[model samples]
Target: MLIATHSGKFHADDVWAVAVLDILFPGSQLIRTRDAARLAEADFAVDVGGVWDAAAGRFDHHQKGFDGARQNGVVYASAGLVWKEYGGRCVAQLAHECCGQELPPQRAQEIAWAIDSDLVQYLDMADTGSAKNAPGGYGLSAVVSGFNPTWIDEQMAGSVEAAEEFRLNQFRRAMGFIREIIINAVKYRVGALLALDQVRQAERLEGGSVLFLGNAALPWSSVVRNEMPEVLFVVSYSMNENRHMIHTVPVAADSFKARKDLPKAWAGLRGGELAAVTGVEDAIFCHNNVFIAAAVSYEGIMRLARLALAEPDPRGA
Candidate 1:
């Protein structure tokens, strides 16, 4: 996944965020820009706009007054503006103000918090009546909601053992699909895109064996769900003129499937019922089209199946 950091002007926070992204995804490219044209092609662009407000001596989105007193007028405002303007499809704001420290790990956690916070606002804004109950209009509500302070604390409070187990499970499920389709016995060239540096393993499946049997965590909005046995898959997409398409896949399951056999299973999963059975409850799929800024929840795995089918067979590549 490509990550682009945009700012109307630079700030310490933007520098820190870029450093964190670099540490997390060494292969991912990072770009700094104020011009809308440069950001048009990014797969995922983070707006550090607010950081420039102090520098520009302008009012930030949060209406925080800028004083030219602190080292020559630097502010944090343009990131949001650029995000609002040319962010196009895959855009997320990296609200770094809440996180006090600039350490890599801390910054990464802050990034997660920002993303989750933004997602909540996005969901709220999309829902009807949300604006009426909200303190301000929809736009203001979104900004306020996106500024989550306790997210990192909450996540950190969770059991480390539990979190590791959950992450491992999700990684296994992802590997299952990858092995089955991309690294099948057919020997297709397979590539992987993992953000948040969450992938723990990408092992090759020896046979069609269902070796491991245990519950795993599935990626939801902010937290990962520990559902048993059956896997839940999520597929999110955004299209760009230059990049063509960018997709996010999150999975949770108990075992692995062979590479060659995934096609039939994937096909069968399309539009299937997602209701939980004995071991799993609240099984569902959430598909978000970032290009259109829309999201939908599916009853079953059909959305993933459809996405898989829609994807060109990389074997041909």
Candidate 2:
């Protein structure tokens, strides 16, 4: 199989599309040329062909009247187009390659959807020149653009092929960066799935509003906030220094505003001062913003969690 994209000034969308093809069709020959004859000879053409025939393995998105978008309405670039056709299978392969685990079909679909929402969709939107929801200039597109070699930088080289070499090297660098990101994303997701049972184990603890865990690194937020809504705090013990941590459930993943924060009095306190106010022995510190608190002992943190749960809240009594 041959994976082809436009030869000059590659964008993030085509770079990623070719990268995905490398994963989907291992050992496929890659050709970078704008010649119609060269593009037509390839088994697959992306970003340069000006066609959107999935059946024909052509996945350009710039053609007139080509109105392809995901269900969420972000228009498809070549990357998104290829993702729509091959993301699930490629994600499953990535899970195995990066995480050493097999992804069930349903789980593969979940991961594909997640990567699309979090990463792929934005790449598509950026390539299409759409306005970003967030403040501009800190996305995958900007990072990939940095890989482009400046003309002055290449002009110093004596060889006539320096410009050509510069573009290819820049393309390789971008491809490597994206490949690492894709693998790490899949690996982290698979690791989260593996840790769900541990979180569930903590959930079965019958007690106050806090769930306790022996492992501080456990990903308890999603399992607790989404699955068991009543959990207000999660106390976890860390073996490194025999410390314990208390975490408040945020209203959302990106939001710092907690569903139930630590007591306002305990905010920004530390050492014996924190212990004195919270009435918990060995209390280490509490953040100024009240999102998290630390204690010197598991026993101390558990008591701290219980005490904070009883503290007055703006939302209720």
Candidate 3:
């Protein structure tokens, strides 16, 4: 199968669209040109073919009367259009390539929806000059565009064909980079879902305002916030032979304020001084901002958590 898109200055939308297509249609020849007749000759077209017929394998979203928006209302770009068609299958294929196992049918659908919401739709917004979620506008677009050949660099190439070849090499590098990103993202997300059971089990044993995790390697913040809001402090016994950790639960995802802060006196203290002040002989350190503390044993970290809770609440009525 032949895949076609426009030549000249490339953008993130079409670059990613073509990259994903390369994965779905392995060994498919990619032709970059703006000639309508030449694009029509290919089995598939994207970005510049000016047609939005999915059945015909034409996947442009630039037609004037075309209307395609994600559930969140982000209009389709070429990346979004292609993802809508084949993203789930692509996600599953990548997962299997990375791991020798296939995702359950339900799991594949769930991850595809997430990829659309978290990644594909975001790219659409970036491509169409629409913004809702990104606070800092420059994201993946900046990274992709940075690969373009500059005037000075192009002149240094000595010929137009050489510059084009250099640009093509950059695109190829970008595709490899994009593949690693997508695969790793799905792998971690799947792993996190698998770890939720561990976090929930710890939540059951929690008492008062503290939760104790037998093992600290798991990502626990999302579980704590969504499943166990009553937990104010978490004391985790890491695999380390001699160290445990304590942390305050943040008030919100974007906020620095915690549900409860560590003792004001312990903030920024360490070693013998911290241990002396907190009266915990095994105390190791407390961060300057009091969000975290370390201790030599499980009991030592527990003491740190209790001491932090005991500290006066300046807001108390």
Best candidate (score: TM-score): 2
For model 2, residues 1-317, the per-residue Cα lDDT tens digits are 98888876887888888888888888988877889999999989999879999889899998899999888789999889988888888889988887788889888989888988888888888889884524667677887877877777678755647776778878878888888888878877788898899888774333647788889877777778788777788888889868999888886878887878888898899999998897887999999999889998767887888788778898773
- The local distance difference test score of model 1 is 0.30
Q: After superposition, how far is residue 78 of candidate 2 from its true place, in Å?
A: 0.9
Q: What is the C-alpha lDDT of each candidate?
A: 0.30, 0.83, 0.80
Q: Compared with the true structure, what per-residue lDDT tens digits does model 3 show for residues 78-195?
A: 9889877877777778778876558886787688788878777877787888863356645776677667778887899999888877777777777776766677767767667767
- Candidate 1 vs candidate 2: which has greater lDDT? 2
Residue pairs that clash (backbone atoms under 3 angstroms), model 3: none
| Stretches of model 2 off by over 4 angstroms after superposition | 157-160, 203-206, 240-242, 279-281
Using lDDT as the yardstick, the better of models 1 and 3 is: 3
Task: Highest lDDT: give the candidate number.
Answer: 2
Q: Please say which candidate is ahead in TM-score: 1 or 3.
A: 3
Q: What are the per-residue Cα lDDT tens digits for candidate 1 across 1-317?
A: 45555432233222323333333345666554445565556544544233333223221233245331212222223232322222221111122222222334443444343432343223222322323224554443233333322446337749755444443343333323322321121111011112212322211111311111111221221222232122222233223211111122223233232121222222212122322211112323222321111113222223333434344544552
- Quote the positional error of residue 98 for candidate 3 in Å: 3.3
